[model samples]
Target chain A: MKYCFGVDIGGTTVKMGLFQIDGVLLEKWEIPSHTENEGAAILPDVAASIEELCEKKKIAKDQIEGVGIGVPAPVTEVGIVQNTANLGWGYKEVKKEMEELTGLKVRLGNDANVAALGEMWLGAGKGEKNIVMVTLGTGVGGGVILEGHPLVGTNGAGGEIGHICVNETETETCGCGKKGCLEQYASATGIARLAALRLEKDAKSSLLRSQEHVDAKAVFDALKAQDEIAEEIVEEFGKYLGHALANIAVVVDPAVIVIGGGVSKAGEILLDYIVKNYRANAFFANQDVQFKLAELGNDAGICGAAKLILD
Target chain B: MKYCFGVDIGGTTVKMGLFQIDGVLLEKWEIPSHTENEGAAILPDVAASIEELCEKKKIAKDQIEGVGIGVPAPVTEVGIVQNTANLGWGYKEVKKEMEELTGLKVRLGNDANVAALGEMWLGAGKGEKNIVMVTLGTGVGGGVILEGHPLVGTNGAGGEIGHICVNETETETCGCGKKGCLEQYASATGIARLAALRLEKDAKSSLLRSQEHVDAKAVFDALKAQDEIAEEIVEEFGKYLGHALANIAVVVDPAVIVIGGGVSKAGEILLDYIVKNYRANAFFANQDVQFKLAELGNDAGICGAAKLILD
Candidate 1:
C-alpha cells in the first residue's frame, strides 16, 4: 500500500498528485509556483505541501516511496537542470534539494518528456514502449519515449522536436534563434500565424475574414463550417508537422505517435489531416504507425512524473 | 579468454570472422552464397562453417561464447527476418535455424545495424553510446545506435534513413517508390545523378565533360581539381544529406554522426561540405555534434555482428 507524489512545476502554477505505486491517483491539487527569488522556494514549497498532505491523512513517512517531478527545462541524468527561462532557474540540483527536504528519494525529467511517458503509461499510447509525443501548445514541444524511457540526449536536449528545421528557405527566426523550425509551423501560435498569412496573401471569400481574432480555434471552427481558406491553412500546417513527424519516425521507429497539448482540443478531425500527410511522406515500411490523441490531457504531466519514480 | 564467431550474410558471399571475446580478430574468411532453393541452404552453410572452424582451432565447445549473425534484411527482436530482397529469404527464423543446425546459442541483427554497432565498439564512434551512421553507397543505408545498441524499430525498420522524404516536390521516384528520399541525393549513385543533372541544365565548363563515365569518384576528382560545376553538384549533394541529418539530430540528439560507404571513400573532403551545410541547418543546442569517417570499412559488418553476442 505504498504511495508516491507526482509534481509538475510550471511558471504559474504547480500541479501535484498523490497516487498508489500501481498508479491509482488518490488525490490531486495545485498551488501557485513561487518563481520569485530565482525559484529558491519552489522545491521547498512542494516538499511542505506533500508533508502537510501526509499529516492530514495520518500517513506514516514509510508509506510513501518517493517524489517524482516534472520541470520545464532540460534535465541531466543526475537530475540537474542547467537552465529554465520560465522558472528563473540556473544550474539547480532539483533531485538533491527535493530529497534533502522530504527525506525521500526523488526522480526528475523534462515536463514534455514526462507527459509523453504518462500518456504511454496510462493514456492514448498505453502499452506502447516506443512512442513519439508532439505537444502543440503556444510553442511546439516533443518527447520521444523509446523502450518506455525518455531519450535525454548528450546535452539533455533530446526530444527537442520543436526546434527541428522544417524549412530552410525562410528568413524569420524561431525563439531558439533557428530559422524555419517545426515550431514556426506546427504550434498553436504557428497555426494562427498561418491563418493571418493566408488572409493577407489572397482575398478569398471565407468565414475567417469576419473574425476579429483568428486563433487556432477560429481556424478549426472555420474548417468545420467548410471555409475554403481555412482548409488551405490547415493543409499547410498538416504538411509541415506531418512531414517532420515522418522524418522522426524514420529515425526512432516509434510504434505510435501521440498528439497532445492545447491545439489538440480540436479533437479527432486534426488526426485525419495529419495522418493523411504522414502516410504520404513516411517511409513505406513505417507507414503503418498508429496515431492517437493523448487521452490524459492536463493530468499527463503529474501521472508521468509519478511513473518516473516507479521506473 | 573466451572466443566467438561473427557471420555476415551478404547477397554474393558470406563473410566470417573468428574473434576473441575481447574484440581481437583472430582470423577471417569468406564463402560463396548459394541463393538457390529460396536460400534454404544459407543457415546450414553458416552452421557448418562455424563447426569446421572450431575443430580446426581445437577450441572446445565451452571455450566459445556463441555465434553472432548480421543479415541483409529487417530482423525482428526474436531473430525472424520477414523479408530480404538480397538474400531471397521470406519469413525465415534465422536464430532458430542457426541454433538448431550448429547446436550453439546465436544472436542476430541487421547488417547495417550491426555495422553501426561495430563502428561504435571499435571504430570511428568508439566509446560512444549514442550515434547515427549513414552509409552512402549505391543506396543510402543507416543504423541508429542509442545507449550502445541499435534502434531496432517496431517492424525492425528502425534507422531507415534513406527513405526519409527530403523533397516532397521531386518528380522522379526513388527505388523504394518514394519521391525525393534522402537516398535520391546522398548515395554514391545519387551523387552521380546530381552531376548528370548539373551537366545537362547549365552546360558549365567542367572536368567531367572529358570523362568516359562520370560517377561519384569522377565527381570528387573534379572537385579536387576545383571545377566550378563539380563544386555545385557536391554542394547540392551536401545540402540534401546535411539538412536531412540536421533533422535527425533534432530527434535523436546523437553525440556523433559517422559517415561510411562508397561515397565516403573520397575521405575528409566529403565531411567538409556536409559539416558546412549541417552547421547551417542544425538546431543550436545540437550544433556541436561531432562528425567522423567510418574507420573499419568493409569489416564493420563482421565486427558488429560479433558485438551482438557480446551485447
Candidate 2:
C-alpha cells in the first residue's frame, strides 16, 4: 500500500494529489500558484502546504515513496524547467530544489506529457500500449506515448504537435511564430478565429446574432443548432485536425488518440467530425485506429504525475 | 564472426547483401526482380539466387545467421508483403517463404523503414537513437526511428511521410488520391511541376530554352545559372521541404534527419535552403536539431535490410 504525491503546476493554480501504487487517487486539492512576481519563488509555500497536508492526514513521510511534478514547459533531462511561457519561469532546477525541501525523490516532465501518461496508465488509454494525446485548449498541445513510454526526444521538447504544420499555405500564424501550424486552425482559438472570419464574410447565421461574443463554445453551440457556417467551420477544423492526426498516425501509429482539454467538451459534435475526416485522410491501412475522449480530464495531470513517481 | 543476409526488393531489381555482426557489408549484388507478372512466382528465383551466391562465395550455409528483406510496400506483422504499389504484389508471405526455402530465419520491413534502419545503424544517423529519414525521389517517402527502433505502427503502415498533408487549401492532388499532400510539392515530380508552372508565367528564363524537356535537374541547373524563375521555384520548393521537415521535427524531435534519394543530389543548393527555412519555421528549442544527407545512397536499402537482421 505504498503511496506517492503528484503535483501539477499551472499558471494560475497548482493541483496536487495522493495516489497508491495501483493508481487509485486517494485525495486531491488545488491552490493558487501566484506566479506573477519572478514566478517559482513560491516553492517554500508549496512545500509547507504539502507538509501540513501530510501531517493532518496522519501520513508519515516514510509512507510516501516519491514526488512527481508536471510543469507547463520543457524540462531538461535532469529535471530543470527550461522556460515556461505561460508561467513566466526560466531555467530552474525544480526537481533538485523541491526534493531538498520535501526530502523525497522528485521526477519532472512536461505537463502535457504527464497528462498523456495519466491517460495511458489509468484512463481511456489504460489498456493501450501506444497512444498520442492531444489537448485542445486555447492552444493545441500533444504528448506521444510509444509502447508505454513517453517520447521525451533528444532535447526533451518532443511532442509539440500543435506546432506541426497542417496547412502549408501559410494562411494563419501560430504563437510559436510559425505560419499554418495545426494549432492556428484546430485549437479553441482556431475555432473562434474561424467563426469570426465567417461572421466577417456576412454569412447568414441565427447563432451569430444570438451571441454577444463568439468563442469556441459559441461555435459548438451554433453547430448544435445546425448553423451552416458553424457546420462548415467545424467540418473544416475537423479536417485539419484529422489531417494532423493522420500525419501523426503515419509517424507513431498509436492504437488510440485521446483528445482532451476545454474544447474537447464539445464532445461527439467535434469527435464525429474528426473521425469522419480522420478516416478519409489517414493512410489506407491505418483506417481502423480509434479516437477516444480523455476520461481523467483535469485530474489527468495530477494522476499522471503521480504515476511517474510510482513507475 | 556471425553473418547475415539482407535483400531489398524493388520494382525492377532485387538487391542482396551479406553483412557481419558489427555492421560491415561483406558482399552485395543485384538481380532483376521482374515483379510485373504474378509477383509471388518470383520468390523461388530469389531463393535460388541466394543459394547460388552463398555457394559461389564459399560461404557455409550454417555460417549465415538470418535473412532480412525490405519490400517497397506495407508488410504484415509476420513479414508478408501485403501490397506494393511499385512492385504490384499482393498478400505474399515473403519472410516465411524465403526462410523455408533458404533454411535461414527471415525478417521483413518496409523499404523506407529499412533504409532508416540502415542510416541509423551504419550511415549518417550512426550512433543516434532517434532519427527520421526522408527520401526525395519520384515521391517524398519517409521513415522514423525512435529510441533506436523502427516505428512500425499497428498496420505496419507507419512512416508514410509522403502522405502527410502540407496544404489545406486543396491546391494540388497527390498520387495517393488525397489533395495537397507534401509529396505533391516536394518530390522530384513536384519540383518539375513547379518549374513548368513558373515557366508558363515567366517564359523569359534561359532554363526553358536550354532543355528540350524540363525536369527537376533542369530546374536545378537553371538555378545554378542564376535564372530568376528557377531560383524562385527552387526557393519555393525548399520552403515546402523545410516546412514539412519542421513539422516532422516538432512531432518526433529526432536527433538528426537524414535526406536521401535523387533529389538530394542537388546537394548544398537544397541543403542550405532547407536548413535556413527549417530553422525559421521550427520551434525555438528544435532549431538545433541536425539535418544531413544520407550517407549510404543507393546501398541504403541493402545495408539497412541486412542491419535489420543483425539488430
Candidate 2 lDDT by residue in tens digits, A1-311: 78888899998888999888788888999888878776755566668878988998888889889888999888866898777777767778898999999998899989989999999988989988789999999999899987677778878878999988776566656788778888888889988888888788875855766788889998898889888888988988998898889878877778999999999999877899999989878876667889999999899999889878866
Candidate 1 regions with alpha-carbon error over 4 angstroms: none
Please provide, for model 1 over A1-311, each residue's C-alpha lDDT reduced to its tens digit, 9 standing for 90 to 100: 99998999999999999999988999999999999999998999999999999999877889988999999988988999999989978999999999999999899999999999999988999988999999999999999998888888877788999988888787888988879999998999999998999999977799998999999999999898888999999999999999999999988899999999999999998998899999988888889999999999999999999999998
Best by TM-score: 1
In candidate 1 the C-alpha lDDT for residue A78 amounts to 96
lDDT, residue A38, candidate 1? 95
- Per-candidate TM-scores read 0.98, 0.86
iRMS for all predictions? Answer: 1.0, 1.4
> How high is the lDDT of residue A241 in model 2?
91
DockQ-derived CAPRI band for the predicted complex in model 2: medium
Best by DockQ: 1
